[model samples]
Target: MPYVNIKVTREGVTETQKAALIKGVTDLLVEVLHKSPATTMVVIDEVDLDNWGIGGLPVTDYRRLAATSGQGSGSME
Candidate 1:
């Protein structure tokens, strides 16, 4: 059995998007590890934008800046 726990900021993810994320990861695990998708489990823990920081800036605001500038999200600093 494969089990994965993912933590992501809540700003950009929707409920279906979250499911797709889990599906994609689980697919890989099942294919590569020969695990059963039915038995595998995936959990996503959402955090507030204020709780996730990148390059000394909040991920919430960083996403806005990235969209405006057409830039990649800032890296951890």
Candidate 2:
């Protein structure tokens, strides 16, 4: 069995989007690694913005600083 964990901020994400993510991940594994969809598992976790941080700052603060500094988009890939 293949297990995958995906974490994102606690922003408003629709259920349809979450379903798509799970399906996409499963499909990717099937196509790339010959994994079976029945055995592939994908779990998503939503973390609070305050609980998520970057560069010693919360995501919200990081985005604010990034906006002011014009350094980065503050988007995680």
Candidate 3:
């Protein structure tokens, strides 16, 4: 069994988008790892911006800083 956890900021995501995410993740697991769709589980958790942080600052603040710094990708990579 493969369990996948996806976390995103609570930013007005639609049910259709969530369904797409679940399906995409399951498909990726099935293709790459040969996992069974019936045994694969994907969970998505929406977190508040204030609750998700990076570099000791909330995500909102981090994004703001990133925007100002011209690093607007919002990715920690």
- Candidate 3 displacement at residue 34 in angstroms: 1.1
- Tens-place lDDT digits, model 2, residues 8-64: 998988999999999999999999999999989999999999999998999898888
The candidate 3 region of ten consecutive residues with least summed lDDT is 68-77
Query: Against the true structure, candidate 2 has what lDDT?
Result: 0.90
Put down candidate 3 lDDT per residue, 1-77, tens digits, no spaces.
89999999998889999999999999999999999999999999999999998889998888888889997885542
Give Cα distance to truth, residue 18, candidate 3, Å. Answer: 0.5
Which candidate model has the greater lDDT, 2 or 3? 3
User: What lDDT does candidate 2 reach at residue 9?
Assistant: 94
Worst 10 residues of 2 by lDDT: 68-77
Per residue, candidate 1 scores C-alpha lDDT tens digits across 1-77 of: 87899987666678889989899999999789889999899999988889999767887677777778968645531
Residue-level error in angstroms, candidate 3, position 46 = 0.3
> What TM-score do all the candidates reach, one by one?
0.67, 0.92, 0.87
> How does residue 16 of candidate 2 score in lDDT?
97
Q: Candidate 1 — which residues are off by over 4 angstroms?
A: 60-77
What candidate 3 gets wrong by more than 4 Å, as runs, is 74-77
Clashing pairs in 2: none
- Best-first order by lDDT: 3, 2, 1
- Candidate 1 C-alpha error for residue 14, in Å: 1.6
